[model samples]
Target: MIRLALVSNKLQKIQLKVFDSSTFSILRCWDPHLSSSRSSSQNLHDPTTHFHNEEALNPTELLNAQITSGELNEDKHQKMVVEELEKVHQNLQHYEPAKSTMFTRLFGRRDVMDSPKGIYLYGAVGGGKTMLMDLFYACCKMPRKRRVHFHSFMLDVHTRIHELKKTISRNQTSKPQPFDVIRPIAEDISNQSWLICFDEFQVTDIADAMILKRLFTELFSCGVVVIATSNRHPDDLYKNGLQRSNFVPFIKVLKDHCDVVSLDSGIDYRTRSSVGKDRIYFVKSETEADREMDKIFKMLCSMENDIIRPKTLTIRGRNVTFKKTCGQVIDTTFEELCARPLGASDYLQLSQAFHTIMIRDVPVLSLKLRSETRRFITLIDTLYDNRVRVVISAETPTKELFLSEGHDSGHDDHRMLMDDLNITAGSENASSNIFTGEEEIFAFDRTVSRLTEMQTEDYWKQWDKKR
Candidate 1:
């Protein structure tokens, strides 16, 4: 049988208890300390207080300012989403969360007031979902607020759950009541932040899919608001996967808690300009591309005063070796970066260690290389979010890197995934839609869009500023 295992051994050591398959129920109990905490607005500096003559603008006004300044093209759909976010921004000014302790939530009457509904913006790639959300997050005056990539956030969640399990296991003196760790974890998060903004929110892994309902149910109950951007709608999340029926309840929870908005303007802003600018992306033959990359690497190394040698990174107690390094730059290949089992944490560490990344020999992605494709997408997302500079040499143009054909239908990766899902060949569940390259096809649009944007003159200007 093909097995789909957890990537981390720490996660594998702790067995997560299966949750009930009924409609998700919110946890009503609250920590007294969190409920009695001071409002974040009191501690933070309001932008309005900075200038006596001008007040802070809401998300709508900020978006209009960008359009008027020619930073962004005007689109009515984007305006609609911004207006909705503005409402939440205005509501939070005078909003008060209901107070509840475990005692009152269980026995006595509890104070209850409605909180503002969060937002989930979904649409096509490069439709300005992230841009608009950033505007909202920037204008939000909440001191206890955090904005992060969704993949990085989930990585942290898994790590926290593993660490929590280890702590609970070491306490030999306490009697174990029916322990559900997600509750305490949610309470801890609520104590830290009242608002969370997530970019590129998605659910693909079974581990993440299973825990979201319980985790979000508790987070929502603690009165933590979320604003997220994604390419998929709530109902379309985790469309098909192993035991997906059990994961369906999260869709309802998300829809009930967040106002779903679509911001598709039918134009991909990232790809409006042509590629091959700034001499960043090389599309020549493999040998020629390698030569060009070497020249660039040496030039970058000459500019830096540090010594040139190999470097090793220690991540999560694991050592990863990169053969080429010169100061704040590293020269690596797609095989070393994406073809192996590296993940978001690994890429996050690499991005932190290096300012400029030179990657050579990126092969044309197909269904046979679905795992590599997924990893590549994650790597680019992490780098792009961090604003790290990337120089790439690929087998084809950036837009044509991922092929749409399905000639490798019976590949081992496809068959293994089907077997792991307990789907037999020729079965209804094993239809073309299940193990096909649909997700990769949809995700490559984003990868290509980001790659195109990374080559723009403006992107290079940002890189220069960082240097």
Candidate 2:
């Protein structure tokens, strides 16, 4: 029962439970705000003293401390988010509700109580939404709590549905409706976790959209609370999809259950983080380029030792190998990725696994290497659709990446390829043309747009482990 005491000039005397390390990071700053009227000899054995001095500061002062110390750059909106999150932290810290068993309820001895209302924090890219959520999740004292990417959570749900279908197949009962499976799934989830934190919560799949309302209803009934972060507000979720009206109830359910907080900090922190950093570099010397790319990989990986590791991704029974990987970042060569025969499915699998990709030494695409260029187009399309971050070292700039140098012998100018496809070079509809025979040239405009956007901090913020 470790306790944390928060002292402010105007707040009630609130004592909170110290559940996890996040509480320590958030509370250590509160030392400076110690009320001056208090006695100096209070016999308090504070556990957080090892990290910070006896002095405590309020949330704003704590944020200011980070800015002054150069640990974090100051953002006014991010500070406001931190302040709001502090209240949530306090609520969660003091949250202590008795568990209700089925026997207790059935015997007419149940106590009526309400669970803590969760928050939905949504905002533009790089607004520090995920960062604040991480702080909240780290300190939340709930014994049964889970933090998962929304796509991965849905993947698990679909996988469970398949398994449930198998069980029903083996049984002698009549066929169960698809909705019938929701109860068992929701019950399983609620039994395991009373609190769920979802990152990048959006509904793109029709199956997911259909099940959310019923599934969440069961979860809420079982006292499960949800905390989520997303780019869209509750009403804007599942926007413009097939049978979207069927998904409307879930929006209402979400609104009814959670308080929506918009972290409209207007600052692109990710882009700010990337300023002057060479995410994409044009190099004349291959050796110099490789060395620089290696350095970037090490920096992004945050590796103390300069040991590069090999990582393998098994896609469709074929194993693809990467030379360097740490956390959600992967470093590989363009030759290994584009030169080899890989399709959209492989790139889609790669996108789901890695958030940031550092590809080195991308040679300018010409008609001679048409197959590789086409594969590269597909790779970029998949990556862009998934909002994965891309860093590259290339012989040419992004605008010149797909311009044909010549045919196989490097003698024939390849503008004729576009002419043969009857797509003019500067045509207004060129970006939307998909039948140029040369796939790379057909998709070049949009691919270039996505590649350029990927280098921005806003793009980095929209990045998700899954679409």
lDDT of each: 0.74, 0.62
TM-score of each predicted structure versus truth: 0.82, 0.55
Q: What C-alpha lDDT, on a 0 to 100 scale, does residue 13 get in candidate 2? A: 27
Model 1 lDDT tens row, 1-467 = 01113124453233222211110010000111212332221101121222235467788877776676556678998889988999889878876454456775456333446667899999998888887887888788767788888888888888999999988888847787667788777767766776899999987787998999999988787777889999998888877655678889988888888999998889887787554333678887634877767766765564355778999999999999998998888999999999788988999999888877988889998877778888998889888887687889999998889987755777777778777777887665575444766777778889888888887544543432233
lDDT of 2 by residue, 193-302 (tens): 87898876877566888899988886776667788988778887866544567888888888887888889877755444432233445454534767656655654454
Number of colliding residue pairs in each model: 0, 11
Compute the lDDT for candidate 2: 0.62
Please give the range of 10 consecutive residues that has the lowest summed lDDT in model 1: 22-31
Top-TM-score structure, candidate number: 1
Supply the global lDDT for candidate 1.
0.74
Show the lowest summed lDDT stretch of 10 residues, model 2. Answer: 39-48
